[model samples]
Target: MVMAHNPKIQEALDARDALASAITRAGVQLPAMDVRTPWAADADEDEEREGDARYALVHLGVCSASVAVLLADVIVRGLTS
Candidate 1:
């Protein structure tokens, strides 16, 4: 059975890719990720579990975005100095 693609997963992937690109352009490297969460793949499972997973992923994404912004700021400062 073919399952429909999950938008949340795509959004998360896009965010990660964008952040990686930004970091690369800034000549900064992020440490390799040690944890992996199957965000979309587990969507069809239990409702409570899926909700909790989604919440956690969203929180992680937010934290990543903040770090990306901080990196950009540091890069800007370095270039200006």
Candidate 2:
């Protein structure tokens, strides 16, 4: 069965997907990228926790130094162009 995400979590998931898509299109792949719901284990799955604690974090996991440089280059090009 699929559980509905709290609004904040849903938003975080959406952002994570969008970011992953954009970066992939830019020729970079972040294999470990995902929405990290640290609070999921501590709270009821369906309940919306209040305030800042409600939001999930987007974890951009580690990559190789070469990949890091490539990511940096992509960012720089994005900003400068």
Among these predictions, the greatest lDDT belongs to 2
- Model 2, runs deviating above 4 Å: 1-4, 39-53
Q: Write the per-residue lDDT of candidate 1 for residues 1-81, one digit (tens) a residue.
A: 111144554455566667667767876656542223455565666643422334222223233666667777878898999
| Per-residue lDDT of model 2, residues 1-81, tens digit only | 112356766787788889889888888888698766656567776653443345577889999888888889999999999
TM-score of each: 0.45, 0.75
Model 1 alpha-carbon miss at residue 74, Å:
2.1
Clash pairs, candidate 1, are none
Model 2 scores a C-alpha lDDT of: 0.74
lDDT per model vs. reference = 0.51, 0.74
lDDT of 2 at 50: 46
Model 2 steric clash pairs = none
